[model samples]
Target: MTILTVNTKAFRPLGVGMRQMIALLGALLGVMLISPGALAGGEVRVTVQGADGAGVEHAAIVLRGPEDAWEPPSDNEATIDQIDREFVPPAISIPVNTRVLFPNQDDIRHHVYSFSSAKSFELPLYKGMPARPIRFPQPGIVTIGCNIHDWMIAHIYVVDAAIHGLTDAEGVWAAADVPAGRYRVEVWHHGLDEERQTTGEIRVEPGTEVDLEVSVEVASRPAPRRRGTVPGYR
Candidate 1:
């Protein structure tokens, strides 16, 4: 039930980074509220691809069930590191209320911030771990980036539902032993426009695996973020 809003006037322009953040937030929220089905146990295997048959990576998936069927938010802690001036892993899925640590593995300091409505905060330039981890208290997409490194970006998919994950190298995402029930699946990718996509009335049953395939037409991926020496590092 917690959402954070931040001002970005002191940092980068509002036109670019916020576009993806807002798009993702809308995607997660729009589908998560759909009416859920009977709760029960099972597995779901999903595949995302382009119409041309290429696997889509970094796509997020969430299975939305009724509030009555919702489990307590998870307390597990996760970590995303800064290495080679990049956000390692780039994207991740975590249950609502999960604490996440962002440790600087690189030699120089970097500033981290997010303007997403789901969870917004800023970590000023620092070279090591912050004194405390950031907790995601709501269900939505949180896009975080470095003020010192414009090209450095990452995503945190904070979900209230029990099952969620990002697609892999082969455009595949899966979850097992979750409450077996009928759910509407929400899918989103950065490559797509602001309009998010939803596909499936998928049902997960005990001792069974449900496989889903979804396709979307998207623009080509943007150029990789830049990397270089700051002021005083060897």
Candidate 2:
């Protein structure tokens, strides 16, 4: 019987090499865990009010930073239904390149149209639902109306910011997990005067909270008159 002698020294380098590879992988994972993309973000709470100090509801608050990127929802679609001769959710905000569906839930048909330069489209006498949705590619305000029902009116605000919030009944809006940086904050409301539409810069720090107060000149616009309900409704 011949006995084979195993050389332990020959396997030493192989074991060392395996240990080194494991260390390298651990270091890489540590770096990845501490990378900027993995860092904790901040939060911003904005409160909007009219000159009279009344809370402004349905106000759009958008934030734009150097790292800001607008990513539409996975569905990339939103719906504005017509019920009770009015557009549900009279105001809405969506990122650019969003497709909006107009579903008429009312018994009557509606002619939805928007002449806004951002997205000019018309659904001629649509009932139930339109065959195709309207795509808003530009960042601007698109006023939607129904030709058949003069009182049916709504506004869609196309914004470039992926991080945005709409003021609630308390006139407060909050954006959480926002990347820490200097951001251009914009507060917009349909009733706000043109001069008050613009807001300035805001600095957000990691793990910190920011509060902002904005006041705007609010104007009263007459609501669209309903057909048959009022005398000489247009």
Candidate 3:
């Protein structure tokens, strides 16, 4: 066999070039790691209450900020089922352009209709599942009701903002992973009187948690009647 001898001096320049390239790549990676957009996000904790200082449940808290370009899940689909002559989850919050399914889980057929300016549609009676889902393209409140059963009612709050949360029984709602920036916060509840909404501004920093407290007025109205054993009877 023939033996080949390696030359050391010939590889000196190549070794120097490789070291320089690695250093340059490392510097670029460092810059990317410290970039502003690469920073961690923050969270917002909201507490909603009524004029009487009682926690308000099912209230919506929406956040609008500079980095609100986020979009809803591509497969986002929500269902509002009718059971026991009432709409399950009386209140729902969804992003604009969301498809909502109205499934009738009750034994009797019911007609679902909404006359809100944002969205107006009617699903004729006789259904387990409609042929297609109802798409809410506009951003506003859409009140749903059954023509036959007036007592069956529900509210859908369509929002353009990417971040929103609903208050729990303790009137606490938290939205996390929000980019740090100035944001406009809006609070809405069904019990409030006409034009029942509150707005405020807040600033969030990187990896920080902000707390907010909001007070709203409650409207005085007769409670909705419960469904009786007979159909169309409340």
lDDT of 3 by residue, 65-86 (tens): 8667777655668899999889
Q: Tens digits of per-residue lDDT for model 2 on 1-234?
A: 011111111223464466566666768876432343432566788877765677777778888886666566545778898987789888899988889999989877789999977889999996798899888988877889988766777988888778776788777898766787888778877664441254667777756667777776663233445657655554
lDDT of 1: 0.72
Alpha-carbon lDDT, every model: 0.72, 0.73, 0.74
The candidate with the higher TM-score, 1 or 2, is 2
Candidate 2 Cα lDDT to native: 0.73
* Model 1 ranges off by over 4 Å: 1-41, 72-74, 193-196, 219-222, 228-234
Query: What TM-score fits each model?
Result: 0.72, 0.75, 0.75
Instruction: Point out the worst 10-residue segment of candidate 3 by lDDT.
Output: 1-10
Ranking the candidates on lDDT from highest down gives: 3, 2, 1
Angstrom error of the Cα, residue 120, model 1: value is 1.8
How many pairs of residues collide in model 2? 0
In candidate 1, how many Å is residue 83 off? 1.0
